[model samples]
Target: MTDVVQNGQAKRVSNSAIFAGCAVFVAGMVGAAYASVPLYRLFCQVTGYNGTTQRVEQYSEKILDRTIQVTFDANISSGLNWEFKPARMVNPKIGETIQIEYTATNRSPRPTTGSAVFNVTPMEAGAYFNKVECFCFTEQTLQPGETVKMPVVFYVDPEIAKADETRNIKTITLSYTFYPSEPGKPVAALPEGNKAVDKKL
Candidate 1:
């Protein structure tokens, strides 16, 4: 019965090995799934994929004489109780830095927080649109009936004028959509006896 005992032990060991291998594989897949989102965002930022624009701290000194019309669009996602819109349209020369404002008002009686997601139109133009400063980079919390004007400073990369695909393009549109921060989270009511702070737009 010694041979029988040895065969059973070998079988058990083989089954244990298979189970261990599957556990490791599953763990690896889970890790990869968790990492995919940030990785994809980084890839989009670098490549300007899907109309994702680039962020910069400063614009180049070279300003092209060519001018392009830039239109701004703002949207509020469903369930976000806020009014959002662009203040104006602008025509800026390539490589000229400009700042534009968007106003957001919290219409709900409760204090609400939102974060904006932005993109550029004519998808190929995204690679050429650069933002020096944008309020969309962070979350904004507004008191009840509060209004705030958020700004975005950006420029069209002068190099865009040299690209055959975008050289002839005369207009670009930047769009933003504000969504409630953390879906399903209850909005907190403004604290009693606290006056809403007046913020300059």
Candidate 2:
């Protein structure tokens, strides 16, 4: 009788342990689902070159020409407070690099953390995108009212000069949009089937 009681008690403990473990697993899964949707959305907004919002895709051949327009669009989805600025932009002839600066702020009442992703599509030009320095590609945490300056350096492939379609183009605007990022979450790819402006020749 004593042995049987002991065995029953051991079995009950084992069952309880299994139930607790399953419960934790389910909770984790639910949390993941909740966090994944927004991150995915951010990914799409950053990567998708859809023409609805502002984007950069062209450059003037005149190096001394400062006539290029720098466009800005603000995104606050991740509860992030931010700003972007042009540090310095050079209108290179054909084989020169362009550099720009961006600034971000944490306007939230509480501490917040996230990352910004950026994409540049040079319409009618084939330029290799390079990041000399930027805050958009990494995770950043800001205290209340804290602000930081970010920089990006990129060059337009001179080969674009060879294309007649890009020769007449007088403007290339570099645009940046901020997106929220979280660990263990999947970033969303740009929206599919949306009519994206054809920047490619």
Please tell me which predicted candidate would have the highest TM-score against the true structure.
Answer: 1
1-201 per-residue lDDT for model 1 (tens digits) = 999999999999999999999999999999998777667777777777888898876777899888899999999999989999885889999999998888999999999888778888898899999987777766678889999988888999998899998898999999998889863332221111212322476
The Cα error of candidate 2 at residue 111, in Å, is 2.1
lDDT by residue (1-201, candidate 2, tens digit) is 999999999999999999999999999999999778667655434443232122234443434322333333434554455543445445544434456555666777876666554444453332323233344544566668777666554544444445676555555555556655564332343222212121121
For each candidate, give its TM-score against the true structure.
0.88, 0.50
Give the clash count for each candidate: 0, 6
Off by over 4 Å in 1: 183-199
Question: What lDDT would candidate 2 get against the real structure?
Answer: 0.50
Tell me how candidate 1 scores on lDDT. Answer: 0.82
Model 1: per-residue Cα lDDT at residue 120? 89
lDDT of each: 0.82, 0.50
TM-score of 1: 0.88
